[model samples]
Target: MRAAHIELTPTEDDRRIARYAAAAIALSVVEAAIPMPLPGVKPGLANIITLVVLARYGWRDAVWVSLLRVVAGSLLLGQFLAPGFFLSLAGALASLAALGLAMHLPARWFGPVSQSLVAAFAHIAGQLAVARLWLVPHDGLIAIVPFFALAALLFGLANGLAAAKLLEDAGRTRQ
Candidate 1:
């Protein structure tokens, strides 16, 4: 039996999504290098890309980029199929769900900053839930919620600001 030849064609939108996913993966790699004070408290730099993609493209494309980042980032970081990978996957799913709802809010009231804040919290909540139910299985795990929430708030705000600035610059350059 001969192997079948395969042809793949990528549209502009596909290329755009790939580029965004690659950028997010790059950010994840860089984030993994940074030493974190807490185990799960690294700055989510890739989320900035997710927020930008969500704003510019849509939730579908954002989902593609976010999920692609989680999978590819895990493979690159040697965490594929590990507990960390599942945690990351759970967080991405939660964040995407939140973004899906948030994107529907009035544009004047909720932009990238507000959306990012919401997604960040959802991301942490998903991770905590997974850790509690699957990894830790201990009631004491709830005690760390405050610390993670603070980190999520701070990092989400910073990432949101960065994304907003990028969007602003992109808008200017389009003129």
Candidate 2:
């Protein structure tokens, strides 16, 4: 007879994971409040929380945190189902995938800043693709890629540095 796979229920430690997820979501909301000159652009400070969760809690929990952030952020901003919401959702999902893949890479090969750059680039690319394919459906929008790339690189570096610093501090405390 073949054995079926069984999933185990959460223990006390699992509750901690849930708490981390909640914290990540809350951080995202707070990050949303900080404004930039551009309307749609953001520093993505919340990514620091996501990165911490991914490094500590694992990818599955990180995903839950990210999804909750997107949903809650949209509702809070009163832009649910709007183009901005879709763009944010796409960017978040893309960043999650990039971060997941980066986590599996050898630690020496990629550090926090590099991982953040890759994830940021992926997020921008994903949103642009969505815009071209579904939202705009016109070639004129392609012109914005260079600007977005520049912004993503700058903000991504900042976010990556912040996350790396947080991680370093956390490690120091643990030691």
Best by lDDT: 1
Q: TM-scores, in order shown? A: 0.97, 0.84
C-alpha lDDT values of all predictions: 0.95, 0.82
lDDT of 2 at 155: 84
Best candidate, TM-score: 1
TM-score of 1: 0.97
> Which residue pairs show collisions in model 2?
none
Clashes of each: 0, 0
What are the runs in model 1 whose C-alpha is more than 4 Å off?
Answer: 1-3
Candidate 1: give the clashing pairs. Answer: none
